[model samples]
Target chain A: MSRKLNFYAGPSVLPVEVLEELQANIVDYQGNGFSLIEASHRGKVYDKVHNEAIALIKELMGISDDYSVIFLGGGATLQFSMVPMNFLVDGKVGDYTLTGTWAKKAYTDAEKIGKVHAVFDGKDKNYTTLPEASSVKPSANSAYLHLTSNETIGGLEWKHWPETGDVPLIADMSSDILSRPVPVDKFAMIYAGAQKNLGPAGATIAIIRNDLLERCGDHLTAYLNYKTHTKSNALYNTPPVFSIWGIKLVLEWIKKTGGAEAMAKRAEKKSALLYGTMAESNGFYRCPVDEKYRSTMNVVFRLPNEELEAKFLKESEEAGMLGLKGHRSVGGCRASIYNSLPEDAVSTLAQFMKEFQRKNG
Target chain B: MSRKLNFYAGPSVLPVEVLEELQANIVDYQGNGFSLIEASHRGKVYDKVHNEAIALIKELMGISDDYSVIFLGGGATLQFSMVPMNFLVDGKVGDYTLTGTWAKKAYTDAEKIGKVHAVFDGKDKNYTTLPEASSVKPSANSAYLHLTSNETIGGLEWKHWPETGDVPLIADMSSDILSRPVPVDKFAMIYAGAQKNLGPAGATIAIIRNDLLERCGDHLTAYLNYKTHTKSNALYNTPPVFSIWGIKLVLEWIKKTGGAEAMAKRAEKKSALLYGTMAESNGFYRCPVDEKYRSTMNVVFRLPNEELEAKFLKESEEAGMLGLKGHRSVGGCRASIYNSLPEDAVSTLAQFMKEFQRKNG
Candidate 1:
């Protein structure tokens, strides 16, 4: 059977090489006598994998000693709560820019812990574009400024980061991390769900600055405390061994296929091809997100009408292009061409989009 | 290559059938056009898996409608905090039994959240035996009474559950959840890390009664609150998809091999054989845990001396018996025989034990 082109957002798509390698070693990892999943986190095999996953993140992002890269569970959603619970202490306000559903969710989580100040909310504009950097003015006593670097549902992304001088910046890069070269030093903390650009759905990566560790709450549980994890090297509990190992392999693949810079170039090509097709469709296809803020990771567009949208989805699915259907909240079409999505898959979608438009128009 | 007789504490042995099935479908899950890991948690494929996993737990344990089986992350450690955070509210004391390392750890986590009362302590006896059921009496105003059903490191298992009427009973059943039949209704909530007797190391299974969930605090974070997770069907976030899917397969295997009853019978036979062998060894093999409270899942023992113990471990590892060494805190040897550990593996270990005694006794 032929491989289908997967375009699902967050639990998006992984490189075939990573999957093949994982499949080959699923039972016995390099003849270690047990599957990576079955290996104890405290043991040598899994310890190597755990450390290597961290090392890869550091190497790929050019991360310095000021930060600690941790592989956590419960996805980025857990981090949404954990970040605030740890940092937003003693009535310190967590300043947030509401770019999409996720940013708003993070704000909700922050409200549970302490004071929250919405620096800017894009929902008034139907979340069609990110807030300008000039418009973000956080409170003087704010603990940190938070934003969603990319909106999976709204298909909006920050072309440039908002300025939050002296207020340690935090970003939920769940849907777009590692897809391109990120300015790691600009943010005090950044987290991403591994399902998107990393490996699978079990692990979430948190790259936190060392000074942020000092801001953790006194009453935080051991598992919830970022400092506990940082001190224990993320072996505070038996970590998601298989998920972390999968990440190590994926990171190795990333290094082999040139670094983050190379990934950025590939993403640009795929996004440009898909977006260019939509732009030239003569009102046949419409992208709701503002052109400047359109996500390179998730390309959201619409056909002429609901009938055409239905027909397009059915036909594309038949042609083995899965997850092309848009998020239910934003009903249209979404071609989530994440980092691992080959250029050929984007090319196929672009060609199909034009052909379908010609027939329907 | 021959498969090693793996016996590590956690992230331990899985059924060979489950491993083989996972390896085959690591890339494409049941020809769903994408891997189980690559599928979106919101998609139909994952939705089916999420529901089925909950159903399987209920079926195997004979759980009633009053309970909700939740797939969570961060392992049982998170539950240690979550249980207290959710239940120990409004100045209510969390009553705990300090039975082993895990139990102490749970107590530590609870202290972070609210008032904790230690009903019983086992460290006086080197954690060799669980407290007598009759001796465990919680405070009348206790919110809940917590204990570890099986101590993986201490090699102790509760022969009878402590009576804690009205105050909800909670247990960390991490080491031996599905290894034998359990009185599900007796405990208001039970949680286990899914590395032993279930699946891999990413997902955690929490079987919580609805009444218990109603007791959750209003101030809890959305992800940390049991009410939030139960209301969302554990879809409060993107779940550990691969781990949950593996659990579905494991539960199916458990049912196919005759459910929890058959597992209990098998555990009895395996434990009897190993323990009986030790008993007949004329002080050659000494088990530290009291025979009445000895664990069928993790059997801890020692040889005549440390030198002999060292030699025994080396020889055993060379003969393909891994993880025979005991935990660092508790010196000597530990043989963890979970549900998936075949009778032959234990028999092989029993035979090896006798032979080693003959050589060096």
Candidate 2:
């Protein structure tokens, strides 16, 4: 059977080099006559894997002493609840900016545990435009100001994070993290699930500022507590060993292949190619999100009608252009071009889109 | 360099066959000409992988229509809190039996949510024995009775699970699930972290009785809610994709080699051989747990003194036997012979144990 191109929004692309290393060790790792999957997470080999995962994250992101990175279980969803459960206390409201579905989920979870305040809602405009960061009214004494850096559902990106100052600026960077250069100094915490750009979806990465670490309220479960993870270096019980190991490999890939800067450049080039093709289709293809808020990763666009959209998806699938269907909420097609997506795949997708539009018109 | 024999407890071992399949997918998966790691979670390929995972779990365990299986994030530790949050309501008490570290953690979480009646504590016997089922007295109109089927830390295994009759019997089978034949009909819910014997640490399998579907208590976060996962078939959120994929491969390996019955028989053989070897060493090697409660998966033992134990561990490491060190509380060595551990590894370890004893003696 021939290899197939995968275009999943997440649990998406990975570097070939990393996968090859994994493949070689999958059956028997380290010449131990046993597969790496069968290897011990606590042994010397995995200790190196675990330690290097943290180190690599730091090295690539240029994380400093003020920031500590921990590999946690649960997808980005768990952090939606955990971030507030720990940090939101002292009766101060938790400020939220609703840019997309994921950020709203994060806000709703905070509502259950703390006083929540929404700065703006992109929903009013049907999420076609990002909430203006300058217009956000962050509370003076709020526990934290939260935002979704990239709204995967809406194809909205925060070109600049709102300035929350001492009031911890928290981000759910699940989709856009590591896609570009993120200034660690700007936020108290940045968390991302290892699906898009990073690796497979087995673990999450939380980079937290040292000061915010001490503010977790009393009711935090030890497993969900960042302090506990930091204390044990994220080995607070049996961790997701293989997932972390994969992440370690990925961070290494990111570092070896010219860091986040190189990835940001590649993402720009690939997504630009696809979006530019859509723009060239005129009225046949119209992107929903405002140009200023357009995501460099997820290029979501719509056709003349639902039938045409369906036809495009079907034809794309036939041609092996996968995961082009938009999220159900958005009702269009989204081409998520994360970091590991090769430039050639985007070119192929763009060519298909152009041909389809010409014939349909 | 030759690969060292690994024997860590959880995130321990995987069948060699699964690893080979994983390796083949590294560069190009199913002739897709792309790495499996880069494949989309929602694509045709991974969709099949997801269904295959669910089918394998259900088929192997002989699960029926009355139960629904869910693959969740956060490992067992998150479930420790989530179970109580979603199931244990206000004014209701949940029954708990404290067998080891895991059960104790569950009990601790339950305390945060509702009144908990701890029926039995293995701490009295230093966690090496099970508290008899007859000794348990449930709270009136209890939510459910929770027990740890196998305690990894204390090397404790229950020969028979206590019958809860009409009440739900929730078991944390994290360590020894699927190692032997289990009556799927006996429990209302069973949760296991897939590290010890399953495949990897990132994925957790939960089997819930159908009747418990409508009983989600109020106040729990929607993402933390069990009903949400059941309705979406564990794809409510971005699941641990690779872990699920690997688990599917592991399940296939199990089925192709022989089903759970065969796995049980193999477990029995390895345990018996290791026990036999330990016995032949006279007073030099002694397992802490009583004979009747001995685990077929993890075997914990000790030397006469701490110095001798240290010497044994060093010699074992030199002989390529890694992760023989036990828990900090136990202060000895533990050999966790999970499903993927070949009997030959046990034999090799046994040979080393005798050699070390001979040299010291």
Candidate 3:
């Protein structure tokens, strides 16, 4: 069966090569007589898979020795609570920028845990805009400045990172991680759920600076604490084995296909196709995001009316495209073209969008 | 290559049928044009998989509407903290049974959260024996009584449950879930990591009685809160999609092969074969676990000496048996015959055990 152009916002697209490799090894991993899923995490078989996944992430992003790379479960949403629970101690506040849906969620969850101040809230602008990276300032007693590098739902992304000297900077890069070369040294930590650019939906990858590990409080529970993971190298408990295994394959695919630099170029080319189509369409396809903050990962757009959008979705799926429907909260369209989404899928979608607009118009 | 007898503790053996289905669907799920791993959790494809997994658990376990079975990540280790955080309120003590390593870990984590009482401490017995169910009692002000239904490392299991009339009973059944019929109404909650009898390592299944969820505080962060999962049907955040998907398939297999009743008979037959082999070995093979409380899932034993035990593991691996070596914490041998482990594997191991003792004795 031919594969569909998967544009759904995460558990999004993965390279066909990775999926095929996963199929090949699903039952017998390297003729070990058992699937890696069944192997003990402590055993040599899984140890290689686990370490290679971490090493690949570090190599791809150029992470330094000062940083520790770890894989976890519970997705990036758990990180929302864990970040503040570990870092946002008494007498220090967590500074957050509510640029879009994901940023607001991180801020909301942080507020429940401890003292959190929103440095910039885009709610008033209907989450279509982002605060200029240099314009936002953290509080005096800020423990960490938190931001969502890309918002999947709102289609706004941080093209430039915030400058917080002496204050730790943390970003939930769940949607856009490894899509491009990241300045790993600039942030204290960056975490992404593996469903998007990494692998499948079970594992979450976090890169933490060694200094930030000291901030993890003793009061935190074992799994909730970052220190526990760092100590055990994320083998604190039985990891999401299959998920991490998938990530390793996907990472290998990325590395073989020219690493993060090539991913960035592909992301640019893919997003440009859609955005460029909108530009040439004479206002038929409208992107709600600010031009500068438009996400290269999730390109969310809308038609002239709700009826046309519904028609577009119906026609797209009939044309063998899936997940073009926008988030239910904000109705329109979304094409999440992550790292593993082929350039051809984007080209096909671009062609589909043009044909849909022509027939509907 | 023929499959070996897999016995590595958690992340242990899964049904060959389930693995085959996983391999077949790894690239394109049921000709859906995209792998389920790459499908959105909120989409119909994954929503069906998630709901079916929950429904199957409810059906197999005879769970009533009074309970909510939700899937979460971070394994059962996270549940160790979550149980006390949600249920162990102020002015109430969480009653615990330190039956083995897992129980102790749960108790230790709970201690950091709130006041906890060890109703039955098995440390004096070196975690080889379990307290009689009727003999154990919860404190008057106890909010809930927690027990480890099966200890994977120590090869100890609870044959009967502690009766706490008014207080809720919670059990970490990570290693022994679905191996036999369980009285769902007796316990307020039961959670298991899905690497053992269920499926794989990424997902943790929690069966919580409805009343317990109400104890979840509003101050708790979204992912940490039980109410957040129950309200959204475990869709509050992105779930471990592939793990849960694997679980649904396993559950279906369990159902088709005559449900919990058949699993119980198979487990009894398999475990008896190993224990009988030890009993007939005349001190050559010794099981430290008290016979009355011997675990059906993890059958751990020791040979005459450390040298023989090492030789046994080496020969077993060479003879196409894997994971026969015990956990690093305990230097012996363990054959984890989980629900998916074939009866023939146990028979072969029993024959090998007799031959090894005859030669070495």
lDDT of 1 at A57: 95
Residues A44-71 of candidate 2: C-alpha lDDT, one tens digit per residue: 6678878988998888888899988898
What value does DockQ give for candidate 1?
0.78
Q: How many Å off is the CA of A339 in candidate 2?
A: 1.3
lDDT of 1 by residue, A327-346 (tens): 88779999998888889998
Better of 2 and 3 by TM-score: 3
DockQ of each: 0.78, 0.61, 0.89
List the candidates' TM-scores in order: 0.98, 0.95, 0.99
In candidate 1, how many Å is residue B210 off? 1.0
Candidate 3, residues B1-361: lDDT per residue as tens digits?
7998887887989999999999999999998999999998888888999999999999999999999999999999999989999999977999999988899899989999999899989888788999999999999999999999999999998899878998999999999999999998999999999999999899999999998877899999989999999999999888999999999999999999999999999999999999999999898999999999999999999988999999999998988888888888888999999999999999999999998888888
Better of 1 and 3 by DockQ: 3
Candidate order by TM-score, highest to lowest?
Answer: 3, 1, 2
- The reply for model 1, stretches above 4 Å from the true place, is none
Per-candidate TM-score, chain A: 0.98, 0.97, 0.99
Residue range A1-361, candidate 3, lDDT tens digits: 8889889898888889999999999899899999999999999999999999999998999999999999888989999999999889867999999887788889889998888898988888999999988997889999999999999999998999888999999999999999988898889999999999999999999889999888888777899999999999999899999999999999999999999999999999999999999998999999989999999999999999999999999989998888999999898999999988888989999998898888887
Sorted by lDDT (best first), the order is 3, 1, 2
